[model samples]
Target: MRLAVIADVHGNLIALEAVLADIARFSPDLMVNLGDLVSGPFDPAGSAQAQMALGCPTLAGNHERGLTMNGANGLDALARPLLSPDQLGWIAALPATLTLLDGAVFACHGSPAGGDEEYLLEDMSTGRPRLDTEAAIRARLAGSGGAEMVLCGHSHVARMASIGGVLVLNPGSVGMPGYRAALPVPHVVEAGTPHARYALLERGPGGWSAQFHAVPYDVETAARQAERHGRPAIAHSVRTGWMPPA
Candidate 1:
């Protein structure tokens, strides 16, 4: 089966729309949203509604937890306005994780034991972040029996790594990518035009192979929307996938 895995859609309706349009071309068996459906420049409600309308299976994201927990740490002022009671309710109702039929487990934000707000950056030092180890990740999958793959997001950094024969995939952030900055950090890809990022997991005869896809959208339009909503920084970052130097 062909499954489209999407994550970190931080309320950029334009980007999400573009990605959905692109997904239509592939016609996968299922569209799975890894979460962070809202909490960005655009309407979180709109994004959540759109995903629900598409009948896609969605997991709870960190932003969703923020909304549910009333701790809007990462959200900007513009994102605050777009959130309504109904939108918050939708986010609160989302499940933290899901297991697919093909032994593929999907977590909206991170590993099962780590919670939804963990950042799984590959370049971190040995014990800097207190993140999960490879053995811990394998232990998380032990309950799944035949499950060989784990899909997760929330770091906004795209990567595919194997831990003891099990594959862990992070599709990256679709609306706002984090690792595409112009910094000297490892795993930092050169900043290019902001585009929608996603993954296509195809089950081959041998095993599952995942292909990462980036689709360019109308960045100017999205930027304009953000600016109009009073989020200039986000708009600027969306136009060029680089966060301004702090």
Candidate 2:
């Protein structure tokens, strides 16, 4: 069966819409959101509402945690006001981890080893970066009998890695990307391309294949919306995938 996995939308409705449209073309049997649905450039409320409308399986992202925790450590100030009392209550109700398909594990923001705060980067060359080792990552995924696949997102980078035959997939950032460092000055540039990023996982007799897909969308309009929202940083980030130093 074909399953679509999306992550780190960051409240960019344009990107999310584009990605969903693309996913529709694939005719996926099921759709799952890794997390970070809202709390960025576009409207968080809209993003959350849209996700609910999609009726897809979703996990709680770090930003959602922030909303639930009332502007916790991991959340940025820009996302604070987006959460009304109702939104906050809804976010708080979500679980940090979820077990899908009877055992397939999924985390909205990070791994079980560190909740929503962990960063599962591709490399751990420096003797492991706390929650960076494969074994440690797998052990965390091995909750109550283990899981065949562990899906997560938080770094805004796209990657697929196998640890002890278990697949760890991060579908990248749907609204904001930081994967291709060599792309340009703006880490996530807005070239007026109507493209959104996501991943499709197909499980069949030969095993599973993860495909990264980028769907084009109206980025210019999205940027304008970001500007109107009084979010210069988000506008700039959407235009050029780079986040300025605080």
Q: Which candidate is the best by TM-score?
A: 1
Q: On a 0 to 1 TM-score scale, where does candidate 1 land against the true structure?
A: 0.83
Quick one: best lDDT, which candidate? Answer: 1
Q: How many backbone clashes does candidate 2 have?
A: 11
Q: The CA-based lDDT of model 2 is what?
A: 0.68
Candidate 2 vs. true structure, TM-score: 0.80
lDDT, candidate 1, 82-109, per-residue tens: 6677766666788988878654554446
User: Could you report the Cα RMSD, in angstroms, for every candidate shown?
Assistant: 4.2, 5.2
lDDT of each: 0.71, 0.68
Model 2, residue 10: distance off in Å is 0.8
Model 2 CA RMSD to the hidden true structure, in angstroms? 5.2
Q: Candidate 2 at 156: error in angstroms?
A: 1.2
lDDT at residue 138 of model 2 (Cα atoms) = 64
TM-score of each: 0.83, 0.80
Looking at model 2, report the run of 10 residues with the lowest lDDT sum. 182-191
